[model samples]
Target: MSATYGVPNLEHCIIIAVIHNDGTMHSIGVINLEEFDNAAAVEIFAGRSLDSEEFAIRVVAVADADHAAQGVFALDAITGAAERAGISLLNVIMTPKIAAGQHWTDLRTQEYGILPDPAMTAPAIAAIVDGFGPLPDAEEITRLFTEITPADTDHARTTQRDNPRFGRDTLHEVRKTIVEYLRTYDPDWADGGVIGADFAADERTRLLDNTAEGLAARIGVLVEVSGSARDALLGLAVIDIPTAARIYTHIANQLEGIHRAHMLAVAAVLYHVDGRPFHARDALYRCGLAVLGESGHLSETMPVIGRALLAAARANVETDTARRFLALGPIAARRFGIETPDYDLYPAE
Candidate 1:
């Protein structure tokens, strides 16, 4: 019998583990039961996945669970899944205190509670051994979206000075500056991120990854450039500038009384191009929109009409409502050629 062990959470995600012949537990991925029921979960373990030797999964973990409702215990859920999969559960466990303290129980004996080794009993250590970072707590995860770092504040000021507002007549000026820099930079300068913090900056250079394919996909290129140009118009607030001028621009962005540093201009354009509406809108809240060129306002989602609505919603940007759809952005719209169609940035309601 293949032995499988896992952790179950009544309140959150349920994890499962793999027990090798040596009796050491190697943690497998967490099977989030928040969206699926026991029967569905059993199907996952039975033959096609995890144990099936599949490839990468880039899906975002989502949930619509009701905490008030009754739910199955993790221990029961995983065992039920194992049985349905025609496998045996050597010893499945679901408990708390992932961070500190020790809790373990004897799998065979009814009389003794086993205090297993700290490194062994903790699922995190096993996962780490298998090359995964320990899962972050909810507060830590939430902090990624909300915290505006000093680098963020400084990026806005510096970006603004280097790239100022421009009407359509003057938009051509960016070709000499931003465009040129994008084209001639050393490939190493645009290298993929070797570390975590470089993700967004690394993302900035992705449009150039497949030049041969990109050349064939000319229209795709236009879409990319247009979107970036629009986002650049909105995101140019990043360049550093004097405070008095910065404050004036902040007011125009319709941030009410919000300060300039909060604009998160670099992040705003990144979000806009990447199609993270919640993040983009949040950047707007901090004043990303203040960077938009006056002439750029002609388009729809350039957010010409929604300015008031967005301003009104500024206070609620911190809510989950603003961050609910953190997903991929659309492609086919990132290029520059005279051949293009005129349409709404905000399509009709």
Candidate 2:
């Protein structure tokens, strides 16, 4: 369904939201109610059914005193069809201009300063819906909104970089917190569910710092990746061994910004200590993919990573001189359990 609606007139904007008892607001869509008659109302809600027990429709008008009456009339006209459809029409709410503007501004971007424009109505509606509940403090509401908004790759990158690494005391606190959260963790989490690049990198750093002896201890293992995390790492294998090694070393040393970068670091350390470079790289790669999935960047990052996986396989399979031998290419891809990218340049032979 279309997420936005409006008219060009200068009077006011009517925001119609069908709010569920569980606090989820299903929007009947917004409109300039002055132009919203019975016909247009039916057009907006036509065939749109709602659970009356769970959902109620509310019309809110963002208008000053000069236009408040008109706004209410607009809501009354538009909601006639909604009332007929058995959708309980709640009170028509009028928001002062200042409050409306504040809510609008908050929804324009995500917490990491990423802009999700042209479809910002949902965030705005969320803010209004949140106000109806037992309102949280400003700080919590800000955090809540940030958590709810879907993040892009840029947001993921920015979050990875901007969040400061906690010191030793803070690390212990974080570990304790994570442990508490995991106690109730669902064992049935989908593969690639637990581990994340950012999360693992931090755990690795803490392990290395505390364990003067070595990373052989269980403390160094960190979280496990469940899905096609291994498949994503094949891209790194395509790079020269030296370059890959350098990348891994740098990530380990500096605790790079993204989760994939952290996995690279883990792979490097594992290669030096464990003599299992492929295994290390695969584990980290999978963990990084989990991070991408968590950050909602998987779909966008998949093609690049997936292509690299397939390319690495094709290169090794065709050319005997290749350094890396990916023995289980097809099986690995299938096990990774995501749609492999269409390789136009290097079609499968």
Predicted model with the maximum TM-score: 1
Q: Report the poorest 10 consecutive residues by lDDT, candidate 1.
A: 324-333
Q: Write the per-residue lDDT of candidate 1 for residues 1-349, one digit (tens) a residue.
A: 0111122222345445454445554445655545657675566566543332322111111112452121234445555665655554554433332322324332323222333433344564655454332333335324433432211223333433455432222233322223433433335443443334355445433432222221212211222234454333322222211221222222223221122222243234334333244444555654434334323342333332135335435664422221121111111112322112222233436
What tens-digit string does per-residue lDDT give for candidate 2 at 1-349? 1123222122366777778888765555557645656577677678876878889876666666787677666666666777788887665555434222222211112221222331246653553343211122445322311211111234333432454431222223323333333333334333454654555556444543442222111111221122233332322222233333333333233222243433443343323222333433343455455447556674444333333433444553312212222222223333433223222223445
Clashing pairs in 2: 192-226, 192-227, 229-286
Best by the lDDT measure? 2
TM per candidate: 0.29, 0.28
RMSD of 2: 18.9
Q: Name the TM-score of candidate 1.
A: 0.29
What is the Cα-based TM-score of model 2?
0.28
